[model samples]
Target: MKKMISWNVNGLRACMKKGFQEYFEAADADIFCLQETKLQEGQIDLELPGYHQYWNYAEKKGYSGTALFTKEEPISVRHGIGIEEHDTEGRVITAEFPEYFVVTVYTPNSQDELKRLAYRMEWEDAFLSYLKGLEQEKPVIFCGDLNVAATEMDIKNAKANEKNAGFTKEEREKFAVIKEKGFVDSFRMLYPDTVTYSWWSYRFQARQRNAGWRLDYFMVSESLKDAVADAKIHTEILGSDHCPVELDLEV
Candidate 1:
């Protein structure tokens, strides 16, 4: 089986200080992906001998960014969804291997009072189309902090958060559309009713109480569903507010 792990490191440099290297080495994933790196090019040097590193940095300094480390070199790599309007945030990185494409994305937050919901909706449409385009060639294993919970079951306090950015009806509907478009939520597919989460807020002792939202995900093309051996959340390991999620594939 091939193993892959994805995490929203929150900040790679800060995470490194908090035992990121130890966890990275121990996890030993075939492919590892990260979101919210919050750095510019050359900001920090990471030495992972056996892996090829690919990064996309937001034009704005100290903001959204993503990186991918893989044991197998990809045939090709691309950044963004090919939409100039949505590409500025350095939110996406796609690595194409012989069998499939690995995409890591740090999806945009709708922001306080849903101020950015309009743009986020646009992003959802374009991103979905981009994945479908890639699927024309091969299956896709896309992972990262998706920034929204697809259903009430995905969040701890669904009723209370009904109007919140990540759990709002608009965001949830968009997430549902992705599944409708030939993708399977790998973790949900394995543990359909598991009450686990990937992200928590620092404000209200959320992680301590395990009151969090399932924001990070690994979604694969529907055709690859049976090849999915296992899916998991590494809630025990911690460096950021969010934890690592893993997927094992028969491929």
Candidate 2:
């Protein structure tokens, strides 16, 4: 059995103040994927007893970044998926195990003014292509904060957010391309009618109201569907604006 967990911690430093260590110890996942680390080089010093840590830091301090903690070491590891421009934010880290490659990405968010929408579109296309390229070699288990709500069911206030950054039509269409390229959203597969969520805004006391979006995800190549055990949202765990997503599988 293999277990993987993904979370957008918002800020690594702040999460540490809100029971992060406790959550990490209890998860005991085979591989843990983290996004929005928001740290610079030499900023964080983790001490996980049994996991090998791989971190990709942004060139800018206290900005977008990602990390992975894997109990099993990969045969090879690559950063940024071979794209120079996309690598700037430190968004992706790929670890190739004997059986599969785990790629974690912290997708670029279109800001409030939606100034980055065009760039975000480019990223979606490039990222999908990158994963497809990797699929030629091995089954892929990709996880992270994708930033967009792929479906209307993915957010509490879907209609209200239809024109918003994360639920925009263009963004949603790009995500559809991913599904067409043969990836399965593990969580939705297990519980189709379930309306579980992974992220909430600090404003309007959204978390307390259970008003959130399913921004984080665990996806795998369609060929690996039979290996999926369960996909869950750990909404009970509080710390970041986002909660954690867990995947159980026979890898």
Candidate 3:
């Protein structure tokens, strides 16, 4: 089985201080991924005994970023899907394993009041096209804080936030394109029930109240569905406002 875990630690230093490494070891994923590291080169180095690390650092330190810790080094590693504009945020890391391509992303948020909504919408188009290009070569396993909730069932009070950035019509439609391209959202595929969430707003004591959103996800080319054994959201494991999401694949 190929087990993977992804989390937006908020800040690497902050998360490490709050028992990040302990959970890292406990989860014991073959491919462990992290987002929003918010650091640059030389900021931190992880000593994961059996894993080879790949990091994509934002041009601006302490900003958007991502990393992958893989037990098996990829035959090749690519960043940003060759999109120079998106590369600035260091949001994507693609690792080519023998059987499939694994991509870890920290997609751009539209920001407060949907200020960057236009850019984020453009992002969805470009990103989906990129993933499709990749799938043309091999099956793709894409996981991250996609920053958009694909369905009304994905977040608490979804109707209340219908006009919000992540749940807006444009965003949802773009995500629909992913499904149209034959990618399966693994977690939802396993559990059709609504109200399961991976991220919560820090304010209003959201996590404590279980008032949250399922913004993070794991998706694979539909052809690989049988490889999916399990998908999970570690809402009970807390540190950042967002918890961890995991996937188990027979690949």
What TM-score against the true fold does each predicted structure earn? 0.99, 0.98, 0.98
Could you give me the TM-score of model 1 versus the true structure? 0.99
Residue 87 displacement in candidate 3 (angstroms)? 0.9
For 31-65, candidate 3 gives per-residue lDDT tens digits of: 98888999898988778999999999999879989
lDDT of 3 at 213: 85
Query: How does candidate 2 fare on TM-score?
Result: 0.98
Which portions of model 3 show Cα errors greater than 4 Å? none
lDDT of each: 0.95, 0.92, 0.89
lDDT of 1 by residue, 1-251 (tens): 89999999998999999999999999999999999999999999999999999999999999999999999999999999888999999999999999999999998999999999999999999899999999999999999999998887889999999888999899999999999998999999999888899999987899999999999999999999999999999999889999999999997
Residue 189 CA displacement from its true place in model 3, Å: 0.8
Query: Which candidate has the highest lDDT of all?
Result: 1
CA-only RMSD, every prediction: 0.6, 0.8, 1.0
The candidate, 2 or 3, that scores higher on TM-score is 2
For candidate 3, report its TM-score: 0.98
Pairs in clash, predicted candidate 1: none
